[model samples]
Target: MKKVCKGLGTVLVLLVAIVVIRASGSAQLDAPKAPAPLSVQPSESAERLGKAISFRTISHQDLSQVDTGQLTGFHQFLRESFPLTYAKLTVEMVSEYGLVYRWQGSDATRSPILLIAHMDVVPVDPGTEKAWTHPPFAGEVADGFVWGRGTLDFKQGVMGIHEATEALLAEGFVPKRTVYIGLGFDEEVGGVLGAKRIAAHFAALGLKFDFVLDEGLAVTKGMMPGIDSPVALIGIAEKGYLSVELLVEQDGGHSSMPEKETAVGILAGAISRLETTQMAAAIDGPAREFFDTIAPYMPFGQRLALRNLWLLEKPLTWKLTQKPATNALIRTTTAPTMLEGSVKENVLASRARAVVNFRIRPGDTVQSVLEHVHAVVDDARVKVNPGEGAADPSPMSPSDCWQFDLIEQTIREIYPDAVVAPSLMLGMSDARHYAPVSEHLYRFAPMMFTDQDRGRVHGINERIATGEYAKVPHFYAQLIRNSSLD
Candidate 1:
């Protein structure tokens, strides 16, 4: 009994010592004190953003649903709105709607930089329009918000970049390396015509970039649980996308005599299995680095757990998975998005169908996800097939590069109080298509958002605060100026 007690005590002391050492070794990363933010007329930017939003350049999965008139109007509006940019830079349209603006640099040796955003947004749901305080397409600036469809996910990026460039041109500022802005018109669906072609154009020219920055992570508040300060998340990598259809076909008859298990029941069971047995979670790649960087800012308990993740990965994963946002960072998620069981209420389903969408995380493949589905479902009654638009995750960008350092320094320079951390982008972006051209591709939007505002992006009442909207232009201008110094 004494020996057992001694052994337990020794283990406890060892654990405590290790935790203390890890915590002590961890240092909180901070941005150096920066100058007061440049005065960009935010109110004017807000008004301009409203006018930009009035155009309904919406992305529809079916090409027939697109309105070409709206695109032309929006294109013309940009030219008229930013006169200095039009005069100073060479603008070209790739694949009809893809907008590319080139500001040629003086030096031949320096590489170029590509700034990206999508000009298109997802169409609002049919019945959800009435729920908005302001109409979705009216582009109303009311109650401090520029309310509209693309405000958050994200025409803010589109207009904001233009707003910055126009302001920079006004000052007669020129870059040492060329600056290219690529705007995709169909990013909300896929960027085949827009970003893909823009990428090809750049490739054809054999023009390599220092980095590519697009819309993804943001300066979000109160989203992460442990950290108190607003975190400026820079997306160094993004999750892959895959959709699988679960089809169950069997004999169908009247509802009078039903079998023990119907076609719909089998399909439901498969979905349930997929949900319950999700792909395994791990803290590696961008996700792992994200936690490591943020650990010093966390509370002692959280800090201790994170710093010693090598010893406590399982329990820590359980804790992180409790929340949906953090959970997504570490795992390939399974969401059953669509269902088609029966046409009529009284009739049995002859063929039942379900579509499960997965945002594949790092360290997992499309094949592995399919294998997991087959293993968990384990039913011959169901047939699994891949849906359209399956994509593997983009290659992870290195955070150690001068490109990342510049973005981090810029974020810190603008918002000295906020903590800057590299993150894995959970959503898909047009930035992914640029990998063939640039090795350093990052996705970050310079807007601060709360938890509620987070849901508004693709949901109803999507908006951006007019006051905060000015920072978008200010940050971009600074980044452009900083990037210019060769």
Candidate 2:
């Protein structure tokens, strides 16, 4: 009994020590430092972006569906809008449509900094055309918003980069390090023919980049519950993609008298099992790194859980999985996108097929995803085959480097209220193609987006606030000048 009492006392003391240490750490997060103010006129910036959105450079999965004329017209529009940029930088076309621009710097030894954005946007859903407040292709500027498909998903980046260059050139600002900008045409459909070819061109020339920046996460507002201000997420790594075809074959017979378990039934059961037994959820990897960066600003209770991660990992993961957005950050997500079985209502089809798509997380591979699917299904009757697109997880870039610090500093200068953190990009981007040429690749768009605005991307009534759209050019200009000037 005495020993038991002693052990209890020791445990109490340990708990008290943990509380004290966590309280000490919380003090460091109490005050968030704001960067210097960014100054710019919003109306003038929105005019150029609105005009850029007028050209419907939509990229379809079927290359034949894309009208190449629209792409050419868009290129012409850019040249006419930014004459100063055309005068300063040398621009060339790759793969007939993709654009690459070079701005020579004073120093020849330093590797160039690459800025990339896609010119193409996803097509509006065919039947849902009438649902938009402003037509998807209209480039309408009304109600303090620039409404269009590409306004958010990426036309902002394309126009913003050019605007920044034109502004800098007008002021006679030249970079000390070479700068390269790549505007890809088919990023919406995997960028294979666009960014892939341009990356090859750079690789063939034996060119290396000091760092690469591409469109990704933005300054998101109201994402974290306990934290009020915006969180600026910078993607240091991107998840991979894989699609698998699950086919089941069985003997066909009349619908009036059929076997107890048909092909359709078997496939349905397998899919259900796979969904129920998902890959384990975790709070480690880049997700953990994200929480560590923002933990200091969170409320006391939230900070306690993040600070004492070792004791609360399971609970934290459970909390994260409750939200769809946060859930994808920690685990490889699986969704059964397509399924086909019977041709007629009265027929018992001999073969049934289903397509399951997976966004593979870092530390997980294409092979591992297949292995898990097979193990969970556990049926020799069903055969699994690789589908069209399959890519292994990408390598993680360094978070602690001169390039990252420069990005952080630039963000502070533009958005003083944002809390910056490194994140794992759950969606696909053209940045993946440039991984081989650059050791440090960071993905961020430097724009403000609310949760509703996030839903608008690839959805109806897509738009960007005129005021927010204007800040993008300023952000890029600061990033370029700060990183290269000295």
Candidate 3:
């Protein structure tokens, strides 16, 4: 009996020891993974793309003129235009206008990839149609490009991607992994009903992607003064936003005999302090990674300056943050957007309120920003409240992996003369919604834009160059072809 009892005790101790070793092994295995490589081509069918651009599918803030009927026509147009894509791929609809298509691959073990673009364009201004050299919805093929609103903002992406898929299908080229195309209907107006609902659809199906590509940055010339080549900026992340309202209440009295500190006076003082004591600018996150990638492409002297960013980052950030455009890249920015006070012109009493909008940097939070505002406007009478406009900054994506390198190499193959660089997007996009689950989220619209073309994005005379328009579809095709599951 004694011998049996001793044997049982030894076996129990061994089992516990094995369990501890297995737990430790699992913890260590969860290290960060490197991004995958992408394979891309540069040739596209431009003639077909021009025809696809002719459709007049526009999105408006007012739901009345949205024209769901036009959207249906546009969908039909896609089917008739790209017969190969419609026949081969599986399509799903998230809502009335939102579309998602999946191109299956040979291997199912590898995670799927998503390419996203919105199909809707903002409504033309009340009388800006005449300002356009070609009508906003004309989709004319003049001056070697397509002239239209959606041509620049997004229709280009939609048409280009579909055209690429169609061409690839013709060549019988198959992807090693599954590729998904997610199209939103209302991106210009926050994409709440469109992209937000689409995200929920993916979540319900337990579909997690390796990466998602969307529109944000583009290739630009003279972006960097010394660099001669056009730089292709791939957005790794975007800033957060919030609107804070400061209010001060005072007893009603005659304007002729007001108190020493009137309600308006108190509000003005708070605004001044908040503007003067802006958030501290820091060099970190995706913004710093952006400079690091382009450093090698820069002149030796400039490269030296960028390579030693750790030491020079603080001073460089402080100086850049002083300018309006450069300032947006470094820290949270504040702008006094709206102000409200008394009801009548003669009355100068009661309550005064001012609305300040803020675009927050990556590391900061809404709570931390609010605390800073309170500290800056150190007045007992002034009360700060969260305004309607507020959104936390999107999470930053990693750039060190093969996913970013693939984007750089693909752009190089097509526009051999252009330089590729990472960037921090100043504005928000539907891309933000996918960042939480995706390892790599890139924002790039593979189209060429000149100085004048840049202004047309949300302004008048929007159009894309003819030669460049033809290459847009080819860029998408190359990106899809270059990507492999291995």
Candidate 4:
């Protein structure tokens, strides 16, 4: 009887092992498959895009330096370049720099789609002209590249969308749903006058869009290792900006005679403490979704690492959020940007202040971040204050919805080799303004760029490949046609 009982126990253990093995195998099999490749048709009207890049509508940090006449020239260039688009669409100027064009569709009951891009480019630093392969604003076409400043940062979107719309109009194709194109003039300085005004205009008109697509992410090769395809990041949300000032005050005296802890010393110590006790990192929101979507494309080790994210989230977050680029992905980051103290070298007088800039992550509030800093510094002598009109992190859009799936499908059609992944944009854009009103707001510029091309954006020798110039517009056209209200 004892031997029979032992035999039954061994059989039960083997059965349990088999069940676990099958469950593991099933989970592996359920992993997502790589999306289908994108098929692109090269644009015949690529020359017009080269001409569009010639305008020098650069936005300066100092508003007074902006050349209004140059912007006017750009407006004229748009009018002359795409005659079909101008003739077919109804264009309206919102503010001095904001341009919005509305194309009437066959079905008005279906929700409209808004395509956004900025017309302005950031000012090139003084005395960097020598580095360019061609002149920055010369808009030279050489070696199958369109060399200019706005070629990548934006104007590519401007021209690409226009070119696509024009091409569709030429082909006598009418969209099933209403299509709106918004071009902001002051994106570099902040879209307050441009995109903000446009959003206000739409709000006042009681207009709501189904989805709005703007410039944010791009398709990149080798961005995700172990994934053979290029990772095309789609910005589902953006980080918030907050400038915190830490002020410390103490008794002043001559340099020869100083207190044990001076104002400057106290401020520096507080800054150091805050830096060492950095914000806690935990993967959540769009960033977590991003990794999950691409996990199947990764190697077996990386797949396992990503699959168990929920279980291993604490350690993974700590490891990934230490670096600037990766940290920007998970939690809010604080950087001590500016310092102010006594004017004279010899006089160690009263007060010292440090301005620390924070890029707040989603799910993080300005109040919460400030509280964390206060706890870390633990200095009663120091006072922490908020900066000018700091915006909180924008709300995240849904990844499981059809809106995102449509975007991923469009990208796959445009760049078949690229894998669509969600990402959190560290910098701000006009897309943030629309988040409150629109259900689905995405940030992505469908232009193919290599590492060198990416660097050129807002840098010296900015340029876009001619091949990309042609492909991007077609991608926009495809997206417009493919997207349905349902």
User: Candidate 4: lDDT over CA atoms?
Assistant: 0.81
Model 4, range 213-319, lDDT digits (tens) per residue? 99998887765667766788999998888899999888887988988889999999999998888887768887788878777677766666676765567777777
C-alpha lDDT of residue 278 in model 4:
81
Q: RMSD for each model, in Å, please?
A: 1.8, 2.0, 12.9, 4.6
- CA lDDT of 126 in candidate 3? 88
Residue 268 miss distance in model 3 (angstroms): 2.2
* Candidate that scores best on lDDT: 1
- Tally clashing residue pairs in candidate 4: 2
Order of the predicted models by TM-score, top scorer first: 1, 2, 4, 3
Q: In model 1, which runs have C-alpha deviations exceeding 4 angstroms? A: 1-8, 25-39
Tens-digit per-residue lDDT, 1-486, candidate 1: 999999999999998898788977545565575543454687788988998889999988776789978998999999999998888999988988888999998887898999999989888899999999999999999999999999988889888889888877777778888899998999988888889999999999998899999989999799778787889999999999999999999999988899999999999999998988889888999999899888888888888888988889999998879888889999999999999988998899999999999999978878888889899999999999998899988889999889999999888877777888899999898888999999999999999989888779889999999877878887888898889765
Q: List TM-score per model, in order.
A: 0.96, 0.96, 0.84, 0.88
| Count of backbone clashes, every candidate in sequence | 0, 0, 8, 2
Distance (Å) between predicted and true CA of 53, model 4? 3.5
- Residue 335 of model 3: what lDDT? 95
Please give the lDDT score for candidate 2.
0.87
Residue 371 error for model 1, in Å? 1.5
Query: Which one wins by lDDT: 2 or 3?
Result: 2
Q: Show model 3 residue runs off by greater than 4 Å.
A: 1-65, 249-257, 341-351
lDDT for residue 76 in candidate 2, whole number 0-100: 95
Off by over 4 Å in 2: 23-41
